[model samples]
Target: MPLSPAFSSILEKEYEINFTQCLPSGRLKYTELCNLLQLTAATHADLGGISFTDMQEFNQAWVLSRMRIEIKALPQWKDIVTVKTWINTLENSRSIRALEIYLNGEKIIGGETFWAVFNTVKRRPEALALGHKHFELYPDLKATKESFSKIIINPEKEEVFEKKVILSDLDIINHVNHVKYLEWCMDVVDEKIILNQKIKSFEMNFMKELSLRDQVVIHENLSDNSIVFSITKENKNCFALQLNLV
Candidate 1:
């Protein structure tokens, strides 16, 4: 697949917020916001000729490794938001992408994501199968005020709940979707905090992948200003999320 003439190093896409994508307060749900960011990134890759459809020819796909998001506000239902995305760096088996969300031309959210090329059939990380040189990289362009960080899981974290991965949790790659990890942790959060939009920023680290029917445990560590959640499988850490409150 060749790069489409419509492709640009920096891609911007507009999305209309519908009712289902919103929370009870009419603001967009966090998970839905993430979906929009990933969707925009995917669209950019598609137009650039390095998308899943192109890489799957060699059994490769992009998988998220880490993500950091800072939010000033959340858009409400019926609002039209623009998502702008670009690659900060892309080489070998890894890439760094930056994305921002705008409402009525005002920036409201910024996100930075780290992705890796994974061989689906071999089930391991690998270099991208397709060429990415057609896409220009902007190493200095950063979306978030703070870059992605290593989330430290507190050893004293309390076990919250446990569940088995279901079909709904799996994505196109036949593994648990990255966003599902956030959804799981978010479900155990205080409803008041979520509805009040007190989350100033959040970060997630995907240490390992989980498949359908995999049993996992959720753990929580609470502090004055932040909440950390870690998911473990068979006593091994699989994912971690840290939510910073306003």
Candidate 2:
């Protein structure tokens, strides 16, 4: 759909890499970067007139489908970085959002995300009301990197750890928040891997929704200095994440 004449072109937010957001290496943690990305998305959505609360009123909500981030460099503790995000495309009940993270006036990270609108009552995907004036207010920004593809599961992977979904992991929708899964995946990986290598890219595919009743097992497949992690519930794939190290 074409953007409205008055649509905003972009949304940007600045954040400092603080101690709490950094890893032992003093760089932004993988999970923390994901948190920043999510926060930026929500803030931009609010500016676009579709905050989570706004969707909840209609018994609807937004769910992340997949995401990929290419990191050229990670911001260190006390370094100021800016995150810029925009809607790149919206169609077939899916919205593509692009993000760019800048450090010291230079681009350091590029990210792409796909989200789908869900009907809370029916527990299924729903088409967005793009014809609505508010939906037309999308930015013209594009991603610095290309979109990611599906992450394949290799059953030969080894089980890394198991975790239970607790009340604190649940979001307002009563489901395990997607960011929590990313944190679980990161925790299962060896800290030495994160400290000794620079993460070149990270991608995640959320295959199925997880809830408080779920007990998940994390599995890992290592190859070529890259690791692929998958969360399983009752032996079924719940989500898969891939991290490429340099």
Best-matching candidate per TM-score? 1
Specify the highest-lDDT model's number: 1
Off by over 4 Å in 2: 1-7, 130-141
Clashing pairs in 1: none
Tell me how candidate 2 scores on lDDT: 0.82
Residue 73 lDDT in candidate 1: 100
Tens-place lDDT per residue, model 2, 50-80, is: 6677777677778998999998888899999
lDDT by residue for model 1 (1-246), tens: 788999999999999999999999999999998899889999999999998999999999999999999999999999999999999999999999999999999999999999999999999999887888878899998999999888889999999999999999999999999889999999989999999999999999999999999999999999999999999999999999999998
lDDT of the candidates, in the order given = 0.95, 0.82
Give the worst 10-residue stretch by lDDT in candidate 1: 127-136
Q: After superposition, how far is residue 120 of candidate 2 from its true place, in Å?
A: 2.2
